[model samples]
Target: MKTESSAELTLRGTKTESRVELTLRGLVLGVVLTVVFTAANVYFGLKAGLTFSTSIPAVVISMAMLRWLGNTSAQENNIVQTVASTAGTLSSIIFVLPGFIMIGWWSGFPYWQSVAICATGGILGVMYSIPLRRALVTDSDLPYPEGTACAEVIKVGSGDVADKDSVESSGKGLKAVLVGSLVSALFLVMVQARLFLGDVAHSFRL
Candidate 1:
């Protein structure tokens, strides 16, 4: 029975050509894009003294280009955008929130303690999702839009499709890389060496 079931599974998976291929491509591109997007966000975060939220935007733009080139499906684009956006928001919260305690923008919590709790919550979220995978993907007819998009991305990468029209702007990724690096470096320097500000003191009363 088990062997028969395994064979059935293999047969089912083989029937989907584009979906599997695209998903693999998406995963590969997703990793590369995540790094690039995170760096850009961090850089802009420092420069503007606020979070830039680049992850979603970057993914959307990249996927939109892919779709325009007929390399990705609408569902695939949606998935990448959702994942990227969530990552961007999470990254911003993780990176910036703890600093609030050190600077006294918030009170009644230790910075390290809050950081630990936040980190734990992030981990738990991932853990919680594992049990639901079957429910989300296998148990019902709910479409896995993000999963489908990832598959499409994989397919495109594996197929080695060329962008013949070259509609995408050149040097955009390079600009993001350069700016992000410079800003993050400067922010680190200032934070570590205390170049700009001292231990600011404050007292607030209601």
Candidate 2:
């Protein structure tokens, strides 16, 4: 076995240390750049379509932006950008799904029914991906750019230096339960108190 002198060992250690620092720096910068690009994707999509498309292209654009702004390695940028972009894409899908009912597509059903379906679909999307994680991340090399981007955002944003704001979303089923209950109770109270009259006293002439 070849033994290295202490000086050679020290030099190698320093080189490794430098590489790690550089990698960290790249990741931090990539995270910021990715956020900017994601905002742009949402703005442009809303402008163009009055709705956002959750296609992979938006995230791909963010990755490109990371390269441009951070001058990081393509592989590193891809990892973070993929994650950030995917979040926006998935969120857009959740936001837009309910609109299907607005233009007469889902008219016959109560509005709350449409809302429930959308909320359910949003939750299901997350669950659906869980089973596919191994296949998508490992076996297929599917280039789930959005998933990669989302992971990156979480990793980067969790840092002390990142913004601390937090937001939570719930399914429409829960919302509907609350709102519907309130509305129904109010309606019942009004009807029972004779505050509002229905066609209870009307006689059909035809």
Candidate 3:
């Protein structure tokens, strides 16, 4: 038997053309996640000068939500993650554009200006990335670590694995998620209560 290529495996074993993949519920969930992740990215970018990728978290959240709904599918979760990741990535613009207003370059981020800048940048990015997708994702031997990890997540959550392995994996994933969530919640509480210094030190005093 011939082994399936990565591209083929990526496309196969899932419903690629199902209407459920683009349902109103899924779109709404995606939009909600997009907003949440975008806000989180903006906060972290401004505070730490860094932003985490929303792809993995979006995938896991989408999978959990769909699983709870009892009609989970890989395609639907993929769509949710795609939408959320796009919105989260666009939040990076917040890091640069606001500085212009602060330094007397622009009075403020005007509605039309912000829209135009984001739209143009997004379109140009998509245009440039098409070739890069072919070269890097399809042709190159480079290990796309994040993409590989996301694929593994999707596969594990796809429910195509053997029952025993699936149960074991799911249990571990749940435990990890719970621990992470608790830690994050605790950190947020500490910051809110001023129990921990969440912001960076701007000055040193003897």
Best by TM-score: 3
Model 1 root-mean-square deviation: 10.8
* Tens digits of lDDT, candidate 3, 96-121: 79888889989877889898988999
- Candidate 2 C-alpha lDDT tens digits along 37-155: 45656555665554333323333343334334543333443344444444454435434654766776755556677657756875887798899755554346344454544434323
Q: Could you give candidate 1's per-residue lDDT for residues 80-164 as a string of tens digits?
A: 5545654465557546565777898777666697768667877887898799755555555654454444444333332234343
Using Cα atoms with residue i matched to residue i, what is each candidate's TM-score against the true structure?
0.40, 0.32, 0.75
Candidates in descending lDDT order: 3, 1, 2
Off-target runs (Cα >4 Å) in candidate 3 are 1-20, 102-104, 164-190, 193-206
lDDT over C-alpha atoms for residue 189 of model 2: 89
- Per-residue lDDT of 16 in model 2: 23
Which ten residues in a row are the worst by lDDT in model 2? 165-174
Global Cα lDDT for candidate 2: 0.45
Residue 28, candidate 1: alpha-carbon lDDT: 55
